[model samples]
Target: MKITSAQAWWVQIPIEADKQHVSDFGRLRTFDSAILRLETDDGLVGWGEGKNAAGSAGDYGTLVHLLNTEFGQRLIGRDPADVTYIWEDFYNGVRAGKARKAGHVMPDLARRGLTVAAISAIDIALWDILGKADGKPVWRLLGGAKSDRLRAYASGGWADKDNIGAQLQSYVDTGGFNGVKMRVGAMDGTPHRSAERVIAARNALGPDVELMVDAHGTYTVSDAKRFAYLVRDCDLAWFEEPVTGDDKIGMAEVRAASHMPISAGESEATRFDFRDLIVGRCVDILQPDPACCGGITEAMRIGTLASSFNLRLAPHLWAGAPCFFAGLHVCAASPASFMVEFSLGANPMIHNLSNDPVTVVDGMVAIPQTPGIGLDMNEAVIEKFAKKG
Candidate 1:
């Protein structure tokens, strides 16, 4: 179907004080994102999400403006099935033809940041259109679903030492998730303090449950190593973002210093960044946030990179409906992916915006089999939480 119109909105949902949590990103009181809607000439519509900030809080005005302006009219008259070409065209800018002819990227200087976020949104919407046109799910188009069921981990844990165990166990109890991830690093103040919390959490959960910690790329090499050493016997499933994403060498050093698996790249974009991580041996697991990264197309490419290099794929899904559902399809089709991230926090975008009700039963989730992303946007939710200029 030929594209007719593309539109975007800034959706900001407030989290109650009790539901709010603090980390290096500060108190996450609001969930923010740019949601896109792409309509075809024949009237079929596709939905997508774009995330600019790391965590859940940021002003999405610029992103929404970009999507509604530059990225919006540009999509008109283009085939919705041209997902990869559109992504490359955006990344390469005016040099798209040259890059395609040369079989190499001639990307713009504005390749990262909000540019990719916009591209990610459009790419996802394009895929959604493609899936709907063919009356098949996106996962089916991406080779095929490796499994009908996908395992997911509880993706939120932010309590202190005393309440950490109870908080995580509640995640397990609520969703039957045996594996859960908790926050560490800057939030805990010190490596030692974070280590103590990990110990305390382990003690409460016992030896059977899997524990993972994320620093949000907020650690120094020495501090990350120290914390890894302290948790050596805790049997952590992974140690994520041991150091800043910019410091790939530092991340590699931290990985080498610990037995725990190092995972990162939620703050990154495209396959090139993931290629660097693989080539540099910076991490054991690759975590690409679909909304911040290049949507499903680039995410599957990153998953291919992970598979080719023996690394694991676990996309960061702390996002709105489009990004989370895109992650679900990516995880469903990629062999390198072992689990999906199901947010345990009070995320209004994920829970309220999509008609798809994600049920994590016994730590596993069923992949969506319906056409498109297997869900429809709740227009009422969008209208209710949409931020106005």
Candidate 2:
């Protein structure tokens, strides 16, 4: 069947917290996402979601406009089943030579940053359409099921200095997560403070529970190394994006200096960027987010690349529920995928946006067996949160 329409919805979902939370990038009070919906000639529909427009207030608008205009218009009457060709059309036709040569950073819908998020959601929606057309889930269509159950880590510990110990303890103690990740460099630019928070998290969780740290590309190589040294005693499961993601050499240096495995790739959007990261030995683990990295199709390719290098793929989860399930399916299909990320806080976007939201029980989650990504978007949630222009 031919693709009929592609649309983007911009919605601002409020966070359930009395005080605003802080991350390495910006404040986390409301989660704004650009959701994409694609329809085929036969009236079948697919849904996908992009990244959180936290810092850039207008990013959601840009995504919505781009998807509904250039990208949307270009895809009309095209075959949605040709996912690979469509990816190349956006990558080669829209990005690479044109944007890179001019240094204009063309609004290619599949590259890095905001535009790629739009591409990511649309790409996922296309896959959903394909899977729904067939009688299989996206993971099953990718290859075969590697495992029916996927393990997830509790992703929280924002505002590192603000009762982090209590926050971490509460996640594992009450939330039933297998592991927990906490932010490190958001408090101050000092490694000592990061070390202190790491120590607090470890002390609160004790030695048995798994603990991870994410600096969100906030530290220099030296500071990353220093903080890694200090947290070495804490036995961190991994150090995620210690230095900036673009700093391959610096990341490699930090990785070499630290005993804890370095995890990154959430900032990267394509397999080429992942190739650079893998070939450069920049990190021990790859953390690609499906929503930002060209969706499930590219994520599978990146997972294979990481496997060839003997590196583990732990899909990142910082977007909405659609993106989270997309990553979950990728993890379920790839045995090399170690753990998925689940936000450990009160995110109504995730909790209330899906009819069958994935839940963590004893730190593990089972993959949905239904067709496509096995989850449906809660239209009411979308309508309630749609930002007025």
Best by lDDT: 1
Candidate 2 runs further than 4 Å off? 52-58, 94-111, 159-162
| Poorly placed runs, candidate 1 (over 4 Å) | none
lDDT tens digits, residue span 263-294, model 2: 99988887889999988889888888888888
Native-referenced Cα lDDT, model 1:
0.91
Q: How many residue pairs clash in each candidate?
A: 0, 1
**Which RMSD does model 1 reach against the true structure?**
1.0
Q: How big is the positional error of residue 327 in model 1, measured in Å on the Cα after superposition? A: 0.5
How high is each candidate's TM-score? 0.98, 0.92
State how far residue 51 of model 1 sits from its true place (Å).
0.9
